[model samples]
Target: MGRSREKEDAESRFNSPVSISVADSSVSLLKLISILIIFVVGVVIGLVSSSHIDRYFSFRADQFNIKNIYFAADQFSSDSEKMLVNCERECALSMESFIRPLNLNHRMTDDELFWRASMVPQKEEFPFKRVPKVAFMFMTRGPLPMMPLWDRFFSGQDVDKYSIYVHALPGFELNVSNSSVFYRRQIPSQHVEWGSVSLVDGEKRLLANALLDFSNERFVLLSESCIPIYNFQTVYKYLTRSVHSFVESYDNPSRYGRGRYNRRMKPDIRLTDWRKGSQWFEIHRTLAIKIVADTKYYKLFKKYCHPSCYPDEHYIPTYLHKFYGALNANRTVTYVDWSLMGPHPATFTAVNITEGFLQSLRNNGTLCSYNTEKTSVCYLFARKFDSSALEPLLNISSQVLGF
Candidate 1:
């Protein structure tokens, strides 16, 4: 009986439920701790990853708010290396603070700036809000003597519809008040001798500077002496809706025409290819870019054509005739009287600025094709007005000129 009791006790100790429950509780506690540790680590990792993701998207949104981007490639020279650098830098900045105005204030050379401006996109459609603006490029000798007249013309017009660029003699500053429209609008200019290639260079420089702004759709070459004969609204509509660019291109076989052709311009520019036009031209943006990008023909003309050849009158007319004849209106939008038939046209003085004379100029009765329809109203601007004519122009501006 004693031996049977000993064996039963030993079996009972091995199969006790209390001992098994204690061991199971310890293992369950270990598993719970492990699971909680793993979940906490996962939560920490998720928080870090989500924070980084938010920052990345926020940075992108801030950087790329710009509506349009014009990436001028790095093919330009070292002097213009700032163009690409500035583009890259500006990408990091807010869209409101974009490219700096590339005008007289900038120190870039004409060659470098022209090369930089020539890098236009091949695509036709713009990716931004494009309000087409006319760029009035004034190639002047010094101060604009007729500032009051221009102020009247530009007054009460939409500021966004137009831009101004002045190419005055180097070191010349416009002597206008702070409220003047022409205040601080000059571009970097070189000395332009009359009837020389330098005159054409000034025009190209103005174009290059203006091209920096992509919104300028039309380019008008004017002088300090030039004045708008019509109101700003009329001029704006006339240019923006025109089917073709107004560039007076004609064949003058006389001494002034064929006599300017240089034989050295043979293979690229032929004698038959020679053309003549007024320096004051109104062209579309496409032609403006073409003029700035032209190196081959420009070099030929600059080297060979000078003195009596007058690159300002020939280079653009001949170049466009050869390449873009179909797009040209083949007429000038500026009026000048060559009735005296002198080397220079007639200059209108204060005495000449009359209501009758101005009306006669407006209605010259010469029928020309406007938008493929015959119209008598041809000129938009006139030049060679003396400083003394400003008062008369201002007095009759509202009634006669409708400014």
Candidate 2:
């Protein structure tokens, strides 16, 4: 009891002095809190030094300029809009191309189709991005007697470079299988006779049919008897690159020329302006359009030209000679042995199917002005071949025609 009372008295003397160890610990605690405060302030200053660009604005802290943030936005939007428009345009063109071949089987819209087939842009303008093609148009009376020869000629060629059209006599059935080059190529045709307006009409129909395809750049008129003298490539190069059309045009003072002219065609087609040319012709797209577009002269020929007048002989020559004389080569690419015939040219039989005769036709000794001046290599096709020449032509096709 005495010891416990002595300890309580000592503690009551706490007011006199504090312990050294307790005082030192309190001072250490104060120093630690001061260091923490400095570190927190330093961190805040570092973050503020790396702030967003919005801080640079002078007037207000929250306000920012859109012109600075969206500088490239307008440009990006314009480019995206252009891309979208281009894609839409291209899609529309592709759709139209898919629908064109289907239109051929529909009813004849000959009058509404005239302007489309015949109207063309100026000489300097060409809008077809597609590769240009050659349209081989055959104005046959009926079945093609020399189709085998033609099949071989057209075989194994690039499908993109050429197209075929046959204006056969209505109801004339051909044995052409679906695999043939001429398969299903027959257009809606009417009856045609020699030396008549119907012949011209037939050729016009071919032009209109071929013109439906915008890619066709050159149009060739062929009869069933006609055979290509050169390979497709040679003929293609000769015609496709030709600046002037190859229609045998000349000033025929003979009874066949101006003699066939109707004086009623005075202001439209004067006798002096009248001309003569072969019916078989190779014309460019421009001339082909002009032919189809010719209501005035075609009317004149239909009214005036007779079998003796021979519209087939004088109509094309006179019209082309009037407007586009200088552009005409004044020659034909098709070879006809007119030396042996009356009104019609001589037809070739198996006897004339020798390699030497064909080679001579290809390299005739005569020179005619082609795309440029006269060249040694002239004829690309020949006409008036009989059906019997088919076998011989096929036999020598590989060795001679180079198909």
> Which candidate achieves the best lDDT against the true structure?
1
TM-score of 2: 0.73
lDDT per residue for candidate 2 within 229-308, as digits (tens), equals 88888898888899988888787776766667778777888878887888889998888888888898888889878777
lDDT agreement with native, every candidate? 0.86, 0.80
Residue-level lDDT tens digits of model 1 in 103-122: 24676888899987787777
* Steric clash pairs (candidate 2): none
The backbone clash count of each candidate, in order, is 0, 0
RMSD of 1: 10.2
TM-score per candidate: 0.76, 0.73
Q: Give me the overall lDDT of model 2.
A: 0.80
Best of the candidates, TM-score: 1
Off by over 4 Å in 2: 1-94, 98-103, 121-128
